[model samples]
Target: MQRFVSERILVQVGLLIVAVALFASTFGQSFSSSDLAQSPMFFPRIILVLWIGLGVISLIQSFKSDEKTRQIASWPRIGIVLVAALIYTNLIGSEGFFIPSVGFAVISLLAFGIRNPILVLLFAVLVPGSLVLLFNHTLGMPLPTSRFSYFF
Candidate 1:
């Protein structure tokens, strides 16, 4: 079987390495069983473990994936996404997460060649809307919002 050394594999490897390094760094933190939530390493360790696990799975999948199915990413689309993400970041404080996220989703989807207006509108709204509801309500984690936060 021919091995594929693509960007997908590279990303998985990079993520795995970064996760492992971060996990290792967590060992220096004070671990107190008394208050798991209060421990500095608690969230980091949890996230790192998840990241490492997912990275390994992705790396294995990448290795097993058929080379014929691999689609090369568009450099121009990537640039658009990067620029859109930067704009999204700046818009978060002023325009709020929901607005910026929807806008970003639309732009990114368009950049990646999704031309269906209905699908685009649905995805752009639903994805960010769900996230907003989940974070703002279900998890009790308030995201950045404009003055009329709930209405957004």
Candidate 2:
């Protein structure tokens, strides 16, 4: 019980450190007054601040808690998803968005214990397809494309 609490405390501290680092990284970003609201750094700064605040709160709570609760977390699943995301990031530029994103979605869902093949297939296709359409057409943002670009 004590070991579990200590482990959770370590995780909370790690998260707090990461959040602080992210918040600090945003300080070097410069945004013009005219485009401050539309600046690329604006949203990230906001999110990082919120993340830091949450980390602080969680860290405080972890130290204050007396409950002897044991949490069962799937750390391997997390690792798999992280690795898949890294691969997906690399593939987006080389293999284009559709194939890599579908693969990522499928792998991530499966890693998280989703077993329904039909649902997984639907999500793998629909999510990326919708995002491609929304970003490419509606938002006018161009995504990476391969030789089969015409299909999208």
Candidate 3:
């Protein structure tokens, strides 16, 4: 009964939906037919749609959960991960993508209770490296330029 709703997931989904809707409204305020294909509304429309989908999924899964009891993760751990992510974003432009991203991942993994150094290191490197390659190289989507200019 108590476990029916995954409270944390629900809260996040709701917040995301609200944020997307707000941004979509703000950005789409002046959208018109004459605008180009990649107008301001384009990205907001995509995000809003995805946010709605996520919210719906979260709502359904939470209502349909079959478990009678479950161990909810500690809020402190999630808070730590969120803080680490903020730090990563703040540092990425000044330090570099690799260093800040790896630090963020490692800290997040540790917060989530994965204590193995090898696994943490692997994840820290792999995820950020893949993102850097895919977004920066393959897609040509420029990320924040690392002030140190160490790697692409």
Clashes of each: 0, 0, 0
Which candidate tops lDDT? 2
lDDT at residue 3 of model 2 (Cα atoms): 44
Model 2 residue 67 lDDT? 53
Looking at model 1, residue 7 earns an lDDT score of: 69
The sequence of per-residue lDDT tens digits that candidate 2 reaches over residues 27-137 is 776667537787777888788888888988887777788754576588899899999999999989988999899999999999999999999999999999999999999
51: Cα error in model 2, Å: 22
Off by over 4 Å in 1: 1-75, 148-152
- Candidate lDDT (C-alpha), each: 0.85, 0.86, 0.75
Worst 10 residues of 2 by lDDT: 26-35
12-73: candidate 3 lDDT, tens digit per residue:
56776696667657654665553657576666677777777777776677666664445657
Stretches of candidate 3 off by over 4 Å are 1-75, 150-152
Clashes (candidate 3):
0
Every model's TM-score: 0.49, 0.51, 0.46
Over all chains combined, what TM-score does candidate 3 have? 0.46
Error of 3 at 7 (Å): 16
